[model samples]
Target: MLTLACSWLGMQWVHEAGHVLGALATGGEVERVVLHPLSISRTDLRTNPRPLVVTWAGPAFGVLAPLILWGMARGFSLDSAYLFRFFAGFCCLANGAYIGLGSFDAVGDCGELLRNGAAMGELWLFGALSSASGLILWNGQGRHFGLGNNGQPVPFRHCAGLAAITVGLISAGNLFFGTG
Candidate 1:
């Protein structure tokens, strides 16, 4: 449980950091980033008016970060490469699961897309893409559905735990904050 909570915390950082990076990259100035159990928040101070692109950036970064790490790990020596590989798979699973689950409600990254006038098809497609990519990466790690030779599928529990905690907390946040 502690591991799951810590990992949940770390993934939230990565998720929000993605938003900060996206805002910065898109020529927006990010004032601050805050991570709560319910959601990762970013204050973009840029008045430049690039809302759609900036909004998409956070989830894009979440999906891409692990893939980037995995790709870069290919260049490392054999022994050291495993660490990056583990993290890559972990990030992919965590982020993908988080997005897939969170999208079921009228809030979160997917909600941001819809509120910005994105079609339902677009939302579903993005969810499928991210989740599929994560599954593919997980397959490579031999841990899909806990069928790996090592018999340790508990890692997926972390993914599910993230999703559960996110949904519960975000729902609570919405109740308290009134779904701005």
Candidate 2:
């Protein structure tokens, strides 16, 4: 149980890091990165009129990190190594979705400068990336909706309960059903 908890925490760290690094690389300034068991809170620069490429980079990196880590872990393929990779992948996807979807708020706020009329390539890209991440999290943990784009404070108990239930189910399935 402890091992699983630690693994989940580690994965969450990596996931949040992915978002931070992506934002930094793309010239998006980070306001805060609040680490928690349930969610990672990040408030990035919304004032700048950044290029679509720059805006897209943060979430792109977030999605890519776990995939790369998972591939590396799979290469090792030792005892239960893949599970670690999966956890990391799930974290990356979830956090990536948050960053990607959350970018909309910024874009919407600076609509006059960044909107670019009807050309919505950046919007579509971010939305798609976030949606993909949400789907991955849903499949792995049965967590469907996150705190909305507003970044509301979700009760820690609720988030912890969901995570606990997910871990329990995964463990039980592995033990009784002999499936990993």
How much is 64 displaced in model 1, in angstroms?
Answer: 1.4
Please give the range of 10 consecutive residues that has the lowest summed lDDT in model 2.
140-149
TM-score leader: 1
Model 1 reaches what TM-score against the true structure?
0.63
Structural RMSD, model 2: 13.4
lDDT of 1 by residue, 33-142 (tens): 55566555544454525666777767777667756766776766543343345555556666666556666785667677677777766666766777776566556554
RMSD per prediction, one decimal? 7.6, 13.4
Candidate 2: tens digits of C-alpha lDDT, residues 10-58: 5544544654565566676765544444543333455334444443444
Q: After superposition, how far is residue 104 of candidate 1 from its true place, in Å?
A: 3.4
Q: What C-alpha lDDT, on a 0 to 100 scale, does residue 48 get in candidate 1?
A: 28
- Check candidate 1 and list the clashing pairs: none
Q: After superposition, how far is residue 143 of candidate 1 from its true place, in Å?
A: 8.1
